[model samples]
Target chain A: MKVRQVSIFLENRSGRLAGVLSEVAKAGVNIRALSLADTSDFGILRLIVDNVDAGVKALKDSGHTVSLTEVLAVEISDRPGGLAETLEALSAADLNVEYMYAFVCRVTEKAVVVFRFEDVDAALAALKAADISVLPANTVYAI
Target chain B: MFNPQAEAMPREELRKLQGERLRSLVARAYERVAFYRAKMDAQGVRPEDIRGIEDIVKLPFTEKSEFRDQYPFGMFAVPMSEIVRIHASSGTTGKPTVVGYTRADIDNWAECAARSLGCGGATAEDTVQVAYGYGLFTGGLGMHYGAEKLGAAALPMSAGNTEKQVMLMKDFGVTVLCCTPSYALQIAEVAEQMGEDVRSFPLKAGFFGAEPWTQGMREHIEERLPLKALDIYGLSEVAGPGVANECLEQDGLHVFEDHFYPEIIDPETGASLPDGEKGELVFTCLTKEGVPLIRYRTRDITLLMNSGPCACGRTSRKMARLMGRTDDMLIIRGINVFPSQVENVLVRIEGVHPQYLIIVDRKGNLDTIEIQVEVTEDLFSDEVKKLEALRDKIHYQIKAMLNVSAKITLVEPKTIERGLGKAKRVLDRRQRI
Candidate 1:
């Protein structure tokens, strides 16, 4: 299943994060699990949100770039072997993950996972073959 | 805000301040540097007659040839042991012109560079990435010391290796960049190609110098980088990159009057022009201990402005935008060309960029000129007729303005390439060294 994610481009400065947070709050978007990527010139704020559309709109309205993508959000166990098993399955299927992140899966005691792979079909097939369930598109997007 | 005290100082006070420093430096020059003393003796310059800065016009002008004649360490005013750092400019016609700095000279250099950066809106809070090729050229180290003096975190990210430069820019978060205007444009192009927005850079501004750039080029850089593009005016001979700098207001570059005294004079007659007159730019290093020059003729074409006071509040004298050169014109064909003229035309040609190559070739003693212009998507995708028409328009404009008729060839966009250090726009393939 695909999870739509939002990435906001920001200059590295004090109070920038505050502006992003303010916009998100005003749009009523819940940032489920977030990650910050940076370079010398700018910072990229990547988030898996409860409402991707609202989050994207909020960032775009604030003059920040919003990139939306269909990504795989697999449900992994909290145990040590969980992540290793998923990674091994993808490797066995000759698939690679371009980027990935972890999120809190409320319905399961296990960890909810979010990932972006260049080849989504191959990755999904590998997960299915390993008998690991990838969450449905709706459930993952509303995370 | 601009400080009005110095610019508003009584003309008599400014004269007196310069006179005192001139007397000391001249006396020191006459005593230490044999070349300087001999040059003065040849011109019959007497110590008591050295009255003031006005008398500086009466003194001999130190040409680059004099430095070449003396070669290595002939221009230094202090002992060799006291010199802390050395820098040299490559010889265009002869031996390399070398400049040295005593410990005190280095300190003054740092202060001048710091002041220039401050004028260009760099603050202690900014992380400065200095990318002016560091080595003997002096541009890189010059900015590095100045950024350090300003108490800013300086990234000594020297020239070339564009990929690494871009990577660092994204990783380290540099806010203020010091480089040539041409290189800044090149970086902006690279960033755009990487699917990154040039405006997304943490950079608030840049101090661009090294080679002559036109106002049109400045506006282009501002449009692409969307930041203040301030001109950094200096030469390796005169303390490098800190002799003057344009503030964010972009009115005129404020010369550091207290340290270096400036004058504009006719290149042919050696007659000094009044304020607001166009002439060759000359400088006298009042506080420079290593190589103190008296009326060092810079050969650059510019104007001087005493125009009331600047918005930045600096009390120093202001210099008008540099147009070109009194000497060393960028000659293409039999007609002489100035880089600024090419820049003026290039900016108006729409799709053509300041990134261009001028090739001057010789065939059986006859000179042939050709311009290699980059073709951006805006120009390349146009019908062949449109592209050819655009090229003809540029050719006609350059010929009309500079009186030089040359062949113009269109290369793929970003293909002529972008340079992030000193922009090498001319290649005289006719002459092989």
Candidate 2:
């Protein structure tokens, strides 16, 4: 299962992240999980929002460089080594995780982890074979 | 001294020589060049009208655009047979401002350059490495022949190849360095990176020109390389890189008044200003044969010092170090840049808005320019690689047009500020105290 993640290129100027967040807020989109990759000159703001289409549209209208990325979301037990176990499974299957971020759902005991993998299909198959629950796009959006 | 008698001649005697040369130059230009003849005729000024240097103000000023309108060789006084070499400055469009030199003109160029090197304390026993670019540009060959004319060992190691330049400097004992000041700093950087102490090398002095440098840069170069850094001034239109040079006194550059007569003029009105007043520096090529220029507006902003003998024992007048330009032309790492040139490149590329900002600054004694341009909504894609490719495309086009590298930052549309009147296109932060 693939979840759509929104990534926006932000110049490394002050208040850029806040500006993007305000735009998403105005669009009535709730960000589920967010991560930032930054260099000296620029940064990439990635977010998994409840309303992807509306968030992307709002950001694009605000003159931001936005992109859509397909990522995988997996559910794991909220234990000491929840992320470590899922990562071990992917590593054993030779699936490279480009990046990952996580958040816990309030209604559920399981922690939801988002991952960008080199091969989404292969990673999904490996997680399925390993008996690790891979969340669907709808479940990720609902969270 | 390259020409001891002329270099040390009395002020009145030098002025008399300049008067004779000016009269001869005006007569020759009036007879040979139709452009000069037409300009003089329109002004109702005859060749005989210019009897001395005082009458020089009556001559019409020669603009750089006249060189472009003439194109390849329309300004040459001599025929193609008498021409010995040609050099050109990069033009805004495709056509460059070409300058030709006769055999005697070449000799004069070499002599001037030799005198310039001598001003930097270079002698016959020294080995000078000419690192300025060769071919079509006057820097390389001008310095090369000048070093040879001074009876010094000339290392014709043109521009680039930093490692090799350092190696030759060490192995051959390069006592004199001839190149842009930025490249001198670059050589020092490479030498340090290679675990070689720049101070241990035989670089006793450096003749840095083709670019505007600050006292801070001079201090940095001198401290890093532990050598005397001097500024040399020239242009391709005015007989290359030896029209003037700073002597050992580290004062203003002494103009080779016997050949090239210097004048300060109000850039707005084209009226000659007296010495010691800051104005546009203009030159009249008094001894040139191929292309004898009259009141050629250099666009360089500087002032002429009082004419007298200096402590260095030179009688020629000196020009203060260049402050800036009368126009918007930016000299980045010795290459001339105009805002319109960048605009020209942006206009040709699709999806790029013509509105742009050029930011020029000095980083590590070298000039760096960053051009921020706005792209259309369709061009602002979600793909990072695609956006990077578009940025690279603009970068490559600008590099091809300007012959200088610049960082291209593709911003969102309307990010660059717009003004109601003339849009502020350039922000030069260099030379700011």
Candidate 3:
């Protein structure tokens, strides 16, 4: 299963991140989980939003650099060894994760982790064989 | 003084000598150099018309682009058999401006340099280090031969290798340091880093040139190195680094009117400006044999001082330190960089927009350049590594073209401001210092 994620390029200037957030809010898009990866000159704002298409459109219309990335949303137990077990399974199958971020779903008491993998197909097959539940695109959007 | 007779010649005698040299130089150029002949013919003037320095206004002015038009050796007045040396300007994009020097021309250059060193109070017992780049660039060899001509031990340090530069400066007990003003400051910084006191060295004076530096920078270098910081001005097209130099008076650089005649003209109208009025500095080679130029327009902006006797006993006219350039050319660490050159490199690369901005700054004691290029839609990848690769590609291309390192930044499309009129391409924050 694949999840749609929205990513926007942000220059390392004052109030740029807030400007992107205000644009997303004006479009009535709710961001569920987010992560900011930064360097000295610029940063990338990655968001797992409820409305991916609307968020991307709003950011682009605001003259922001935006892109859509297909990632995996895996549901894991909300326990101490949850991430460790899932990573062990991917390592056993020789799959690599480029980057990953996590958020807890309070109602279900489960951790929802967003992962970007180099070999998505192989990673999906490995998770499927390892019996870890991969959330569907619609399920990730609803969460 | 190196040549007291020429340096301190009376105003009437100096003017008489300049007038005679100007007449002979104009006639030689009109007869041998086709470019000068065509320019003079188009201006409805003849060699006979320029009878003296007072009639120099009738001669046509030469622009830097004329050198590019002539390419490698098209402008040389003498044949290859008589040419002894050649130096070129670091042209970033197209063909470089080439200059040729005959044996006697080189000797005259050395003489000018010797006089320049003498202005800094250097003597035959002094150890001089020439830190300008040697090959192709006129800075290094120009100072090297000048030091030797002055009977001083010339150390051809030739720019870069900061560690070695500092070590030799201390070990050799260098008395005269000839380099770009910025590099002189860099050397002081490196010496400090090595836990060595620059003041403890035998450095008595320095001849700084090949770039426009401010009085504040002069104060910084002098204080740090604890030596007299003298300003020397020259360009490769006009006999290189010995055209003018600051005598110990440190007021303005004294132009060597005996060899290279100086003039100031309005940049826009090309009309001659009065003395003490700021305008573009133009030079006419009075005695160069290989490639004598007639009224060459040096785009550098400065004013002429009154022709009078100086406390240093020199009666030659002086030119104030350069204020600014009339063109968009940027001199980063003694190397010429134009915005169009960077655009040339960007347009040739795939998935890069022509729109760009050049940001030049002085970090610590060195100059740095950062170029921001807009990324096209096709090139903007979600992965940061891909964008970094694109930046690296642009960086390598620029380095290969300009022979200087730059930090290339990939910005989003439409992020760099666009102007309705002439685009603002350069953000130079270094000039403030």
**Candidate 2 DockQ category?**
incorrect
Report the first chain's TM-score for all candidates.
0.89, 0.95, 0.96
lDDT by residue (B292-357, candidate 1, tens digit) is 877888888888996977777677788987766665455332134556567778887784454678
Stretches of candidate 1 off by over 4 Å are A1-143, B1-12, B329-433
Interface RMSD of each: 14.1, 3.4, 1.7
DockQ (model 2, Cα): 0.18
Supply candidate 1's per-residue lDDT for B390.
74
The whole-model lDDT of each prediction reads 0.76, 0.88, 0.89
lDDT of 3 by residue, B1-433 (tens): 9999999999899899999999999988989989998999999998888777899999999889986789898789999999999898886759988999999999999999999999989989999999999999999999999999999999999999988999999999888999999999999988899999888898999999887788899999989997899999999999889999999999999999899999999999999999989999999999999998889999999999975678999889999999889999888889988889898888888745467899999898788999987665556666666667778888999999988799988776687888899888999998652
Candidate 1 chain B, poorest ten consecutive residues by summed lDDT: B376-385
lDDT winner between 1 and 2, please give it: 2
The prediction achieving the highest DockQ against the true structure is 3
lDDT of 2 by residue, B402-424 (tens): 99899988665567888899888
TM-score of 2: 0.83
Off by over 4 Å in 2: A1-9, A12-14, A29-143, B92-94
Winner of 2 and 3 under TM-score: 3
lDDT value for model 2: 0.88
